[model samples]
Target chain A: MEDNQIKNNSNESQKASANYDVVIIGGGPAGSTAAIYAARSGLKTLVVDKGLTSGALGITSKIVNYPGIVEEISGAQLVEKMREQAKLFGAEYISDKVIGVDLQSETKSIFGNGGVYNSRFVIISTGSMGRGVRIQGEDRLLGHGVSYCATCDAAFYRNKDVVVAGNTDEAIEEALFLTKYANQVYFLSQTERLAAPQELVETLKNHPKVILYAGTKLKEIIGENRVEAVLAVQSDQHEVLLSVSGAFVYLQGGRPVTDFIQGQLEVSQSGCLIVDSSFQTSIPGVYAIGDVLCTHVKQVVVSAAEGAIAAMAIEKEINGRSRMMVDWSEKKQ
Target chain B: MNSVIHVNDDQFEEVVLKAELPVLVDFWAPWCGPCRMVAPLLDKIASEYSGKIIVAKVNTDENSQWAVNYRVQGIPTMLFISKGQVVKTQVGALSESGLKNLVNDFLAGKN
Candidate 1:
């Protein structure tokens, strides 16, 4: 009996050491939103992120489209605002990549560069990653004129000639935004027609500072240390030199980072989490929200809403667990 | 939060067996504390690896027949199934990396 008691005590200590109320992975919009809600519910919440400055929406230069923000705001500024809001609610922020998570034990643990974190609930908000521009000098020239986010670095090229590469709505909108700061903005589309919205297309067409080039593929970005020019292939197979101080590659779709959670969770071929209406996955205490889930449209507002809903469900689960403990205690007495 | 698809006996075969990717079925109950601990990890993984895998849950309390057939002796038993066969069985909670290695191996056609 004494041996059994010792074993039980060790197990209890292990459980206590591994226990946390909630640990949210990814400090982007979805994760931060979840943190705000979770912390507001009086749960001990920790948000782990990779410290990437630009999220999906952070790539946009001016977001006049997002609801509630009457005036247009830069993507970086908006994300910072969101981060501040989450912090205001007492959400602890941990800047690190979560290498792995342990869910099989009674106390869930998140393994990362910093250390292991144990939590009963976790929200994964690691947004999609920008697809790499596979070519020589691309990596080396990164931040030297070759950039992915137009919103974050567009201001740096004020009064200078710049090139925008992409055919998506966000890309077109970014090009339009660049016209304000850039002397001349070239909107290069690889497709025959611009894949952006009709309204955005009309806006770009009428904008005098913007130059639209269709079926133009970026061949190579040339510069000694900074981007000075780009070799572009025109639709007629004509090669043209585009002189620009900076080049913004605005690829639309992004790939999710799900390699870390592969076998334990059910994911779509596209790496989006499959969830029902309650945002619950195949596992009970687990829930997914935002761009990571299987959704037709990926937007900031949608992700925020999903975060709220997931937090509410987690709250219910926590309350249910507490009630069960109370009932057990009463029965024992 | 999106609603979870309740994979009962009627939809089990189609959702779990016919899935193109490997299916991870978590057998759990509401009152189980360990089951609660593992739920978020499963959800994080399901969303993180969506499309590459299919995640389903069988509530032992609600789906007693399925639980009986699987001979589940405890809550939070995870069965990793591929090609309609149980490839791996984990009885307790697992770390994210531990789960990732298992799934990656299965996806890579490695035992």
Candidate 2:
């Protein structure tokens, strides 16, 4: 009995030192569902995300179309419930932005803002980013004159003119921040009315340094090496040229946030990660799901189903056979 | 004043600006949803970096002097103060690990 206890203690220590069986790289519905399935199957799982409110689902105001829930629920509330369910199943969660990843080896390595983590299976469900203006020369001049993060890149355009495209809360906030550094800030909203909060809208509209252009569509971001001007069409269908050094876009449409693992996976033109019916990517032991995957529908229900499929597929691949077999005996031995 | 110190107008100077370690000031209000979310994160950060940093909170409703002085227009604004000077300021709610990264980056002098 003493020898058996010693063996059990050693086994527990070894298990504690082993890496997680699966590491999910997003905490949306898809990743959380995958974590639930994987952890319930007795596999160690970890879900790492940038933050609780970083994903698109996190920012969605309301979700009334999701089935089975009669009353409308906030997107954040739904995500929180999913996260709690995943935690109940014994899946560990970390709120850290993944900076780098290497999935070629037996044990995948994920380097995040917090620290390094290793897992046997890597699931890329990083979801999508805010859509960008897909105009001509927009992609060619990303860093030279275009920027997404006002906090990170706003200082570069000090005492110069800049154009902010979009009418959301983030755009208003970034435009407000730009007023601190730029000489004049132009806010071009595609729609006639801005869709931000009342307080924020009032502040930006009344600001002396801001120039509001309603019902404007971005025709092109004109420049060679740097952003020299922005060609846009006003509500009257008149083309207007705004000479600026930087143009920031914050559109509403979804664009996959797969920059961290672009070359590592087989991604479609729209930035969606391609996967087989089993949710497995081109690489072995690697899977993609949720808004990051190229699915016909990007609803929560579909993503959750895909996550379950991927988790079962991963279990079958790792355990060598299905665990669905039952043992029956007519007589006791 | 154990892990997360609640500083008012009177104790602000001594507990935050003149403290031995770097201080993180979280300016919050009770009505703010994001502030409520970030309050626990600040507590976790305080416990994690006990010796290296100090975390403090100032209720903007009760104390408007510091808020006006810093021109804080929003709730859930965190100010990183070191050597009696405000170094970095972020306005929004961050996750526990995200807040940890900010503290680590500040300690490493990267931000």
Highest TM-score: give the candidate number. 2
Report the number of backbone clashes for model 1.
Answer: 30
- DockQ of the candidate models in sequence: 0.02, 0.02
Report the Cα lDDT for candidate 2.
0.75
Superposed Cα deviation of residue A72, candidate 2 (Å): 2.6
Model 1 interface RMSD over true interface Cα atoms: 20.8
lDDT of each: 0.69, 0.75
Name the weakest run of 10 consecutive residues (lDDT summed) in model 2 chain A. A324-333
Model 1 complex DockQ against the native:
0.02
Highest lDDT against the true fold, candidate: 2
Which digits, one per residue and each the tens of the lDDT, describe model 1 over residues A21-121?
Answer: 88877776777778878887777888876553535655556777668898778765676687888788787776544555655555666765334568888
